[model samples]
Target chain A: MKMKLRNFIILIIAVTFVSGGLFAQKKLTGLEIMKKVYNRPSPKEMEAKLTMTLISSSGSKRVRTIKQFIKDFGKVEKKIMFFLAPADVRNTSFMNWSYDDPNKDDDQWIYLPALKKVKRISSDSKGDYFMGSDFTYDDLGDRNPEEDNHKILRMEKVNGLDCYVIESTPKDEDYMYSKTITWVVKDRWYGVKKDFYDEDGEYLKTLTLKKAENIKGYWIIVTVEMFNKQKNHKTIMHLSDIKIDTGIPSRMFTERMMKRGL
Target chain B: MKKRFFTLIISLILIIWFGFADGLQITGYVRNYDGVLLNDDMDFSIVQNTLDLNFSMQTSKVGFKVNPYIYQYSDKTTVFDVREAYLDLFFNSFDLRIGKQQIIWGKADGVFITDIISPKDLTEFLLRDFEEIRMGVTAVKFDYYIGDNTFELVWVPVFSATKFPEQGSIWAVTPQFPIQPQFDFSRKDIKPSIKNSEIFAKYSVFSSAIDFEIMGGYTWDADPVIHTLKQIDPFTHQLLSLTAIPEHHRLTVAGGSFSTTLGPVVIRGEGAYYWGKYFQSEDPMLKEGVVEKDYLNYLLGADFTIKGIKFSTQFIQQYILDYDNFIVNNEVNNLMTFLARKDLLSGDTLHLELFSYFGLTDEDGLIRPKISYDITDGVNILLGANIFFGDKGMFGRFNKNDMVYVKIKYSF
Candidate 1:
């Protein structure tokens, strides 16, 4: 009986040390982790040439070429994208000005060469697809972390790297997605993978970052893929010739520039 | 003069090709249309070949665009025309455009209310697309941007009138009274000179929730005034020496348009008030005098998309002020239009569209259905048909003009 009690006490002491060590390591809240991911260091301005390949369920493919530009203006960020190839959508351009305030919606406009006019468009519907792609317009912009309730589910290994598995649920019930599960690389604060759930809590899509590169001390996503489970379709985006801190002028994101086409 | 103009255009093209080769972009389409009339057994068929050329170049502060069109009809008629040629100068807060251009200012579809700056071509009536029917005008436009508002001013030195269909054509309006039908009639168009040039101004504001614009203009009426004079024929003793003279009169227009989104649907509306508009009386006796009246035209429309299908509908109304019951048959006119479009294939390479228009007061309507397929990049094939129904109205008059057409286009 004495020997048995001694062994039990030793086991308890080991458990206490392990638990104490884990507690002393300082566990991060989900919000804190996401804040770090959101505030990750990035270039003030950037330009990239992207090739988008859309794949159908039957394996048919269509390709599109685009040029993208982004500039930061203290409290606001401006982005402009122009279609360069694919005769059908050639010369079509889209511009957006995103504000820091979550209450202030983004200002968006589209320029259709056929109409020779620049039309201001509403961006209230966050669920709408962007350019027939799996990504929504909200996905292209910076989403405020405060808009969602985030919780750390556990720690897991993704691509042989330690990551934090987080589940985020939108505060607004009318949101397009009921919840999103993200796997963020622990040390680098990179979102390596994400799973999107529909309003019914059904798995709808999966997004994976296939490639990432570090340039001038800034990490950039070079290749990404989104697969829509419901539609059996997928879209792959490959970004190249990326230049950061290029001093892109704020005027480049104007309606006049949209009409001009890149 | 025609030869000189063609030579000048060719020279300009050559200059652009050599001087600004890197900045120049040449893109247009070559299309062939084969149409056959469904009602008449008289072989009412037509074939047309069209080639459009557009050249544009832009720098940081200045830009220029030139478009030339060439058309050949099956009737052995060929014509060359310049659609647009303009030079743009940009400033920090304002921009100026000089030369010939097309300016559109309305929110209605398949109707004209505030979109009056550009004249229209009625050669094929309403069979062609509205964008194709709009002809450019030579003018100088200055746009000033202040905050979220844009102020635009336009001045046109030369006057251009709308082109109407040829006489004895299927789309011609038949007259009520007939005398010596063989009598020749001449038309005189009163064109405003530089001294009486046209001027227009508009102020527009764009917001996150809605966009709105207000505009006013003093210009010549796009419609012509018909002045019928009768003379006695010495041989027939019949009032057969009739002459119809068409003239343009001065008019003023004030209009505004607003567009906003309500949930997933977009709502748009436009209204225009015309002062001193000429209208022909239905009664032959009253037609001798040109009647001038003020009228208001308005349109309301909504568009939305559901499951990749887009649907749009619009309601239009025209009200004439101070209407004389004896002279005017109807004081108010109403019309409605609906359009639907759907795209098939993963990349939306195949498109289908249906459009319909109805005249509520006249009880006449038209339905047009079209399908287009992209054979390859920069190439497309389309099949469409126009069906008209009614017995005593505008569309009713063209019931026999129903036609089916096939078009193939190659763009570069």
Candidate 2:
């Protein structure tokens, strides 16, 4: 009995040491990974071209190839314009004049053909639907790490990939969403799933990342789905046939281009 | 024959314009309402049924609109106004329009979330099939861009009905006694033939941190008094001569709206002051001689939208500017005396004020919980029920005077 108790105590100590070693190993927090991955592209220095395909449940489909250019001055004013569409939407585009400062808000505009106007929609109204889509203008805006208050919850496996669970709360009260819970992969900082809560702290929407692929050394999202809980509406954006680093001009982001019938 | 000619023209225009569109968008709603008679205590019954049709082009290049309506009352069924016949032209930065349209001006609960000016009060005014502003007018609106912000300027010239009660209007006999000192008013002699005319301007700066908008405008009126008014003339030495005179009635309004972000909540606020030349008799000696000046109406409000639900609170005060010009009657005297007597016992002064509010959609949202309270008399309250549809759209309300109102509204 004494020998058995001694062996049991020895085994327990060994297991504790191994567990401690594993726990103490270097692991990146969610915020750190997000910051690193979000800054991976430069529209000015490095160029990337990509295509997205959106397949609807009713057997409808849409495709787009977006060519993005990043010019980093003191503040980052990234220009993301559309490159290809099935229709004659060659010059049709959107521009994001974003500032790196957390205190300052970003300026965004879309060239809408229906109104035949380039509307400068207020950033505070960014949470509204974009042309009846689930993605708000804010959702499509360039991600800035400093605008949100984030906390790393835990390390978990999502879609068979190791990911860090993160919770973020917007500092602005006018924001339509109260809090967002994101599941991001540790290696590439790609978000897998996100649960959005409204201002009243009620679960209002969900965004799911379906497929991810590596295209020309750039990680790209192949499929994405967004659902509005209260409105019973869903929008899916698909991206495929993506090629990065084809020369796009800075003049494409001008109002003259938007007025040229897309 | 005139009405039929107008209808035929409108129909032809709509059909011809719709035929040229590639994709058509049809959007409208039908409403049904049942209401109980308040005067006779009749049981709840069918009050109205309404149908509305809106057809537009997908491209929104060009379109025509028509809204026709009919209403059935207890004693009679009536075909009300068929308004909103207009041509919409969209240019690069300007929108030009002409027709019998709804031109909603003023920042007093308009355009942002509700139509406060065009149709007046939602529950009481719109619910009733009263004469809306059906004028043959033209408008040109320009939205200019400066960086990330936009500057909007709109000019509308309308020839419509009376804006306020004068010699021949319904509000001529009304009296003003406020619950607060901040709201005050004054009046002057005016002719009743003047129509409503004004130019509205708005400069708005929209941003995430601060959204600021300023609006101001003016209106005119001059007409004969419809209701009975105590009259006196200084030059003629006329004692209590009942007559009407052309008085210049003008109004000026200015206001601003601000919205800011505080942590996890969005705070929106707006306030405005309206100055006009309308007044009441302040002194018993000069009650019929001179009109008091400085009629004032101001409002302050705030609303918070958290999650999907919205909560709002607003306070409005209206008072007499020159108390000496107030013409008090037996009813007003009794009410005041009773209130003073009650205040002596309760240690609280009775003040006349009207408080109202809504939930969900300020007034433009889906569901409106609207209420009006008279703080002067035991806080008498009036509430509007759900709205139904018909040639005359229908809605019912229970008022403080034990009066029940069932109204039908129709607009083309």
Best by TM-score: 1
Give the per-residue lDDT of model 2 (tens digit) for B279-370. 43445465333453444444444443333223344444344454452443111110000000111111011212122222111121112223
lDDT of 2 at B390: 20
TM-score of chain B of 2: 0.57
Q: Provide the TM-score for each candidate, comma-separated.
A: 0.84, 0.52
Worst 10 residues of 1 chain B by lDDT: B180-189
**Candidates in order: C-alpha RMSD to true structure:** 9.4, 15.8
Per-residue C-alpha lDDT of model 1 across residues B1-412, encoded as one tens digit per residue: 9999999999999996788998888888899998888964734556889998888888878889898998798785697899789999989889899999888776677788988888888778877756578888999999898765789999988878888877777777765545543323344455457777899999987665677889999999987776566666778867755666677778999999988877667788999999999876644466454688999999999887766577889999999999986544468889999999886754566789999999898999899999998776668999998889988676878888888999999977
For A1-262, candidate 1 gives per-residue lDDT tens digits of 0011001001001111223244336788888777666655556777888888888898877778889887777677777889986765788998777776656666667887766666655556455566566777566555567779999999999989989999999999978889999997775665888899999999999988887666555556678888999989998888889787878866677665786676
**lDDT for each residue of candidate 2 in A20-128, tens digit (9 for 90 to 100):** 2443467655566556545444223333454444333344434445654444334545454554443223335665556656656555555543223344433454554
DockQ class, candidate 1: incorrect
